[model samples]
Target: MSAADTTTPTKVPLPRQAPPPTAPITPPGRRTSGGATVPWALLAPCLLILALVLGYPLVRLVTLSFQEFGQSQLWGFKPAESVGFDNFAEVLGDGEFWAVVVRTVVFAAACVLFTMVVGMLVALLLQRVSGWVKTLINIALVASWGMPIIVATTVFKWLFDSDYGIFNALLSKLPGVDMIGHNWFASGPEGLAVITLLVVWGAVPFVVITLSAGLTQVPKELEEAARLDGAGAWGVFRYVTLPILKPIVVMLTTLSVIWDMGVFPQVFVMRNGHPEAEFQLLTTYSYDKAFVVNDYAQGSAIALLTVVLLLGVIGVYMRQMLKIGEVE
Candidate 1:
């Protein structure tokens, strides 16, 4: 009893400590509620404006998709009644529709990729240039970025026109480009190539400006440190510069996707809405159905499909942004 009691009597009380401070948690892509709450008064104006400007048109378009608004409805006094999912069935059931959808996705992707690459290169070039050359570049960039879409398309047409195009003129002088006219719009591929070049040319300026700005935000010391560590120029950029520029690059690339989706004027004017052109992108198809073919309800359905496709693309981008925001 004496030995057992002696061992049991040595119970020292443990010291209590305050619980470790809980870390502040924030949902991804959302601001933490740690600061003063935003007043509804400050947000209401924006919300109302958005509702009228964007919300109403979107709802109207969606509603239009379900109605059979044909030629008779468009010009006639007869009101079009809701036709349920008939418009959707017609658009989705068609083989040509799916073909156009696939083509649209590929075309948009190509344009975005090329535009990003060219823009990045131009941006890098701008960083290395200075003095009057840099000033001229900046001026040229602003002009290109600000140019009218129609005007740009027109200029591109002149540059690529088979008979009188400067491109053909240059190519004919080369070793074996005997195809005199080399019709840019002779086939779908040729037409798309011209449009792609036009889009890239116009889009590069914005990309250059944006990437150049982003490059400025990168810490110079980090770059210097990397270089001091014997990293080559490409290595420094790959490891250090690119990591900092990633967010900007992703954003600009997504914007390019959106801009490339509805490439109407370029394709329309180039093809002159030729039915024989073996390719059909969603934008042109929708316009053809709605206006050219005079099938408004079916056209609206296709238009809605385009919107849905865009939303899918945007959702992917938002997820990436949210992940980045959460990590910080």
Candidate 2:
């Protein structure tokens, strides 16, 4: 005891410091009362920019839809007179308008169907192909996708030219299938079909890329398990793959509907910027009303209606996405 006490000094305990100030812990999937405001604060600048850029135009469009805005008013010779829903009534009552609506819906549906099927097939092919082959196909798709709309339309026009077109040339080679001098744009149905093809061609690239990325995320174990459970190729795809791919498919279909319904440049340029009455979709109809007839109010009304339809589609898409997220 004497030796130990001499060698070692008496120990003294240091006082513990209080814990540093910290934020209150939030449970997973829950936020603090103030957390909701944080995101809004960060988004404020972007919201402001969007309001500045789009708000005024949208307001003007709505106003125009409810007024009688014409060339005279546009030139400042007269003020726009309020017409209430007259423009909407006129558009809604027009038999041609209804016809155009039906045609537009069918065209968009066909385009969406073809685009999804072809895009999915190509995505599956990409998964099975050699690396270099897939790379080449991707390059081709990107090249087509990156092509200017006007340029692509013009190219398609040339390809279907009645006087000298490779399409007719190629078809003529088929035994007894004389397609020489066949005018693809002579009829509305034929012309719209060609336009559909063009649209599908341009749209497939994005669909392929998106689906390919999604396919990578699918669990291989589930696929193997399905196969082991006596699922054939089609059975596995129908039972396993399709369920997982539903969200992407729905999103793509909605977007395609919006785009295909709003198809203007392809139809316009294909017909030399003067699409025939038979060729008119909602976008072209609006343009024709506003510029060709100098009826800006009616044009705005049609455009507003188109926007409503698109909003409906978007709402459905958002609802489906939320449901998918909830399921996940």
What TM value does model 2 have?
0.89
Tell me how far the alpha carbon of residue 321 in candidate 1 is from the true structure, in angstroms, after superposition.
Answer: 0.7
Residue-wise C-alpha lDDT for candidate 1, range 254-321, written one tens digit per residue:
78898899788777766666544355788889888888888888888999999988888799889888
In order, the Cα lDDT scores of the candidates are: 0.85, 0.93
Evaluate model 2: give its lDDT. 0.93
- Per-residue accuracy of model 2 over 266-290 as CA lDDT, tens digit each: 9999999899988999899999999
- Residue 248 alpha-carbon offset, candidate 1, angstroms: 0.5
Steric collisions counted per model: 0, 0
The ten-residue window of minimal lDDT in model 1 covers 270-279
Question: Candidate 1 regions off by >4 Å?
Answer: 1-49, 273-279
